[model samples]
Target: MTEPVLTVTSLVKKFGRVTAVDGVSFELAPGASLGIVGESGSGKTTTARVLAGLEEPTSGEVAVAGEHVRGRSRRARLRRARRLQMIFQDPYGSFDPRLTVAESVAEPLRLHAPGPAADVRARVDALLDQVGLSRRAGDSRPGELSGGQRQRAAIARAIAVAPRVLVLDEAVAALDVSVQAQILALLDDLRRETGISYVFVSHDLAVVRHATETAVVMRHGRIVERGPTERLLREPAHPYTRLLIDSVPRPGWDLERLARDRRALDAL
Candidate 1:
């Protein structure tokens, strides 16, 4: 069996008296995608933050490529960042208003591996192209682009460093259905091309189903169900998971369909 690229053991995060993440644990093999699904305040984002090294865990262990993350020293933080990067939900705010797309993507590369300006420009252009952005788009600020364009730029920045794992916290929740599909496809393509792993956090089950092979359902700061994404969503064991799956709106799932199903079951 291939070793997991990312592992979380008994991870817990507390915000003073509030227990945001409670003893959550999971693993993702290299090139695999794992979805973390839950409603608001269910600790999905908190877990992603902990994994991304943005928020220090109150207690627990997060290991990347078999090496356990240590103290929050500068070196440790830098190491964690190089091993894993995060794409936050807010694409608009994630980038600086003044810096253009290329500048934003090149910022991390320069910080982590500074080199000649020409080399950085070359890498930035390559990354922009990889994310389906034109060289001209690289010169535009985040506000000048559409929402989907900004998001693609954000993805470019996240993958520019070639991190082993990506922690995506509601990464597509704000986009329209069409744009969301495009972004999801881009993410899968990136995984295939780079062999990178993902820890996808979202409340949207349909989006999760499209992006992940395996999934974990969280409710009130604890994992309630976990398994292959198809099986878990098709036959959710936990009541909370069932509620989440049912809450998603579907075509032909209106009063008429519900009544029809009720009548069919009654006749049976």
Candidate 2:
């Protein structure tokens, strides 16, 4: 069997008295997509942060491409970053205001996938094109582009290093449905073409169903339910999972009832 590109074993994170993540565990197979779905404060973002080495875990283990991301030193974190990367929610904020999109993408190439200047330029151009951005888009700064455009550029930067895994924390939550669909398609295509695994963290179940093959649903920092994404959506075993599915706005969705349900669930 192929080794998993990413692994989490009993991961936990604490912020003073608050436990942001508790015993969260999952695995991402090579070229596979796994969703970590939850409501805000459910610890999905914290889990992603820990996996990407942005937040040190209070406890537990995370391994990316056979290496630990728990390494405390800057060199160890940077070395782990070469194997794993992240695309955060705010696209425009993720990049330097002073840098053009090309420069932003080129930074990783220069660091992790170092090559001659010409080769780096060529790679940046190819990455921009791969994400459906125009060559002219590369010349623009993050603030100069639309949200969707900036997101594509963020994705380009994240993938520029050819990392084995990507942890996307609400990567599409900031976009409209159309733009979200486009980004999701782009991610799917990239996974198929490059064999890159994904750890997609989001509160939106719709996005999870569309993007991931398997998922874990979190409530209050612990995984409440987990299984194939389709199955969980269809036959959720936990009350929290059922609540999440019912919370999605559909043709017949009743907002008042869902609000009540969520309140009751939260009280538990």
Candidate 3:
């Protein structure tokens, strides 16, 4: 079996009296896509933060590409940062308001690989194009762009360093439905092309189902259920998992249609 590119074992985090993540453990194989779904305040974002090395865990271990993340020296932490990048929920908040889109995307490359000025510009341009933004977009500031465009620019920056793992913390939740679909598709394509492992954290099960092969359900800082996405959705094993699945809004599914669909499935 291939070794996992990212691993979290018995992870725990506490914010004073509040337990944010409790003994959460999982592994991500190289290029694997894992979706974590939970309601707000369920500790999903905390887990992502811990994994991305943005927050230190109270206990347990997080490893990326076989290197330990916690209790590392400053140099070690910087090394980990180079291999792991995070995409925040709000793209605008993450990007510098003063910096143009190109500068935002080029920031990582500059930090990690400071070389010829012309070379950095070329690489940034390529990353912009990779994320479906035009080279002209490089000149525009974050405030000038639409929500989807800003998110795309954020993605461009996230992958600029070619990190092996990308932690998406509610990355698409803020976009409109149409833009969300497009961004998700773009992410799917990027994963396929780059073989980057993704830790996608979201509250939307429908979006998770569309984007990920595996699903882990988190509640109150604990993982309640985990399995293949289709299996978990079709036959939820945990009560919390069932609650989450039932809560997904299925448009046009009135009581009558729901009953009919249940009956049809039962007949199968």
Candidate 4:
């Protein structure tokens, strides 16, 4: 069996008296896409933050490519940041309003890559093209672009460092259905081309079903169910998981069709 590219064991995080993430644990194999599904304030985003090293865990272990990363020094934390990149739900909020698109994407390469300034520009252009954005977009600022464009630029920045893992925290939740499909396809292509593992966090079960191979359902800071996406979506063991599955938007479900779909999916 191939070793996991990322691993979390007994991860816990607390914000004052509130327990944000309670003993959460999971693993992602190289190039694998694992979806985390939950409602707002269910600790999905918190878990992603912890995995991305944006938020330190109160007590737990996060290992990347066999290196255990716990509470390390500032320099060590920066090194770990290079290996794992994160794409936030709000692209505009995550980026600097003052920076142009090219500047934003090149920021990571500037900090991590040792090369001439001109080389960084070339790499930024390549990264923009890789994420399905035109090189002309390099001149535009986040405020000048559409929501989808800003999100695409954000994705470009996330992969600019050539990270081993990408933590997508509701990356597509802010986009229209059409744009969401495009972004999802782009991410899939990137994974195929670069072999980067993904930790996808979202509440949309349909989107999760379409994008991920494995699924973990979280509720109130605890994992309620986990397994192959198809299996869990079809026959959710937990009551909360069942509620989520039932909530998926389907056309003309009425009653009989819903049963048929559930039966067909369960057989998988």
Clashing pairs in 2: none
TM-score of each: 0.92, 0.95, 0.92, 0.91
Among these predicted structures, which one has the highest TM-score?
2
Task: Tell me the spans in candidate 1 whose CA falls farther than 4 Å from its real position.
Answer: 251-268
Report the C-alpha lDDT of model 4 over 1-268, residue by residue, as the tens digit: 9999999999999999999999999999999999999999889999998887778899989999989876668877777878898998889998898989999998888888868989998999899999888877778989999888999999999999899999998899989989999999999999999999999999888889988999899887999889999999888887678766775767764676567665765565
**What lDDT would candidate 3 get against the real structure?**
0.89
Output the worst ten-in-a-row residue range by lDDT, candidate 2.
65-74
Candidate 3 regions with alpha-carbon error over 4 angstroms: 251-268
Clashes of each: 0, 0, 0, 0
lDDT by residue for model 1 (147-185), tens: 889999999998988999998998998898899889999
Instruction: Write down the worst ten-residue block by lDDT for model 1.
Output: 257-266
Residues forming the 10-long window of minimal summed lDDT in candidate 4:
253-262
Q: List runs of model 4 lying over 4 Å from the truth.
A: 251-268
- Which model, 1 or 3, shows the larger TM-score? 1
RMSD of each: 4.5, 1.5, 4.8, 4.6
- Candidates 1 and 3 compared: the better one by lDDT is 1
User: Candidate 1, overall lDDT?
Assistant: 0.90
